[model samples]
Target: MKVPGTINSRNPNSQSVFENSFVKTLSIAVLMGIFLVDMGLGLFEIFSTKESPLPTAVVLLIFAVIFIAGMVFYEKQGLDTLSSLVGGALAGFGFSFVFVSLVGGVQFALGGGISTIGWDQVISAVAASMIASVVILKALSYKLQNHLY
Candidate 1:
């Protein structure tokens, strides 16, 4: 007999601990932390070196790895592709915006007076984030689906 308010360990339909929403949220939070660290470090590198290509490449590589890992994690949890895509995009945009603002604030503190932030820059960051999210989600979903079966 199943006890009230308690999960049945023998129940085949019962989800594992990792399949719970709490785990999902925790995983996403971890991914976001990774994203922020990667972005902050990448920005520091670019600013310190005054060279763009190498830093950009390194950042993209880090992003790609995280995206794939996130997608795989979500897939294992039975999350749909659309949800993953939207979640990834939102996380990316939010982090990117914060990163940009933080960089601007640091610059202001370092003798560069506060300047108006252009809407174009914000829009571009959002657009780039969304594009990257979509591409990563779609490609990973396809690969995961085929590999799982």
Candidate 2:
């Protein structure tokens, strides 16, 4: 049996230099900061526009690219299940927020006004995205652990 605090026994050879808890936490925090800033900029772009969808489209693209890059980095580094899950969840949550904001912006521009959008809608979207992301990550982790990936 493997020790609780030790590395995974199945992939004992897959250790990375960033296996330390502090480094992992710090890295995640930094990624979160980036996400928050990007999200803020996207929101600002949304509110500052009533004539073009280009800005929201660009924000959506950037969010997708950043999230994809982060996931790819984790995959290449062979990070543990927790790391992958947390990374996916963060990226998914951020993307969901940005996407929802973009939709709201479009609606506002199209005369839906602000009454149709509320914190409840945004929270629900984020929560649903978080749940879906966790489920997906868990399944992928299981597949990878079983060498089915």
Give the winner by lDDT.
Answer: 2
> What TM-score would every model get versus the actual structure?
0.31, 0.30
lDDT of each: 0.55, 0.59
lDDT of 2 by residue, 1-97 (tens): 7865665555557667598766765555555444443344346446667443456577666666766777777777898767865786578657656
Alpha carbon lDDT of residue 149, candidate 2?
Answer: 30
Residues forming the 10-long window of minimal summed lDDT in candidate 2? 32-41
User: Which segments of model 1 are wrong by more than 4 Å?
Assistant: 1-11, 53-149
lDDT of 1 by residue, 102-135 (tens): 5443443343331234445534554555456556
Clash count per candidate: 0, 0
Candidate 2 is scored at a TM of 0.30
lDDT of 1 at 32: 49
RMSD of each: 13.6, 14.3
